[model samples]
Target: MDEKRSVRISKTLSRVLRHDPASIGITLDEAGWVPVQTLLTALGRKGTRITRDELDHVVAVNNKKRFAYSEDGSAIRASQGHSVAVDLGLAAAVPPAVLYHGTTGAHLDAIFREGLRPMSRQDVHLSADTETAVRVGSRHGRPVVLTVDAAALHAAGHEFRISANGVWLTDAVPPGHLGRLAR
Candidate 1:
């Protein structure tokens, strides 16, 4: 498929898998997986006809590795970034000494005071590299990268998990653990 079409399908998949499976007449289990055949049928009913091969291609070539198939190939789910209340089944892992969060400059004041909360999502998403964080921040506005003291947070009993796609996940990053990175 062409890039535009693939992206459209990917976005639809993300919406169904991460936020609202009910919109497509499906449900994600506690671990956030839905049977592959059920997903395809629902997509068909919803007027988005994606063949198995095309789905496989999307899963394989998505830039962010956003979707993952179950080990037996019978199910699929988003790797992370869920807005609905489904567990991702990720184990807690030690983060690096530092991690990065990207956002627009406009949010800095609130962040400085309130810390980085998940807002609407389940966890605060973080990046392992500044460049990726910058890219993510660019989506909101003028990008600002913030450094996170991951080791310190972990030492203080904050849990962290690296998603299958490598995005860092944590409940929140209090302001005490954050510092503005110099541009």
Candidate 2:
């Protein structure tokens, strides 16, 4: 590839990985990492023809460290995709009042407090425990806390109900309230 051609691919890759290409009038989907077909199409439209071998070579040679291939190699994913995953499991039962999420402009905080109900049934994957709750919360820049005590919800006036194969029960708490219960 010529210097200018190589520069174009690099630029395209950066935008495609960092943000949805569709947002800027470039139509391409993140096929796991980078859709091979999309890359070829985009390149073709720009008067460049890229082969699968070239795609593989570009993926291999690029050293910016933002791209990754799925284990099955079906798709590609940018390291900076959308959310960050954190496991916030405090070994003991001492819960936190509020989970601190990402810094400024992290919109996940709102998602944690409101829950995913507004979106759709398919998006409603509530966090199962303090650990997962915090992670799910962090994805949007806010953390979540348990509403009731994990050890003694009944004693705390919560009716005991079990779902998730007898491990946990779901209940409601005040909006934006974080409970820090003792073990």
Model 1: residues >4 Å from true position, as ranges? none
lDDT of 1 by residue, 48-152 (tens): 999999999999999989999999999999999999998887899999999999999899999999999999889999999999999999999999999999999
Residues 1-183 of candidate 2: C-alpha lDDT, one tens digit per residue:
565666666556656544545443354342324455665676577666766666566666654344556567655554332222211121223222222221122433554466323131111222235565554455665443434332343335533232222123223332343343232
- In model 1, what are the clashing residue pairs, if there are any? none
Q: lDDT values of the candidates?
A: 0.95, 0.42
Give candidate 1's whole-model lDDT.
0.95
Residue 95 C-alpha lDDT in model 2:
24
lDDT for position 71 in model 2 = 66
Clashing pairs in 2: 31-76, 32-75, 32-76, 32-77, 33-75, 33-76, 33-77, 108-140, 109-140
Query: Clashes per prediction?
Result: 0, 9
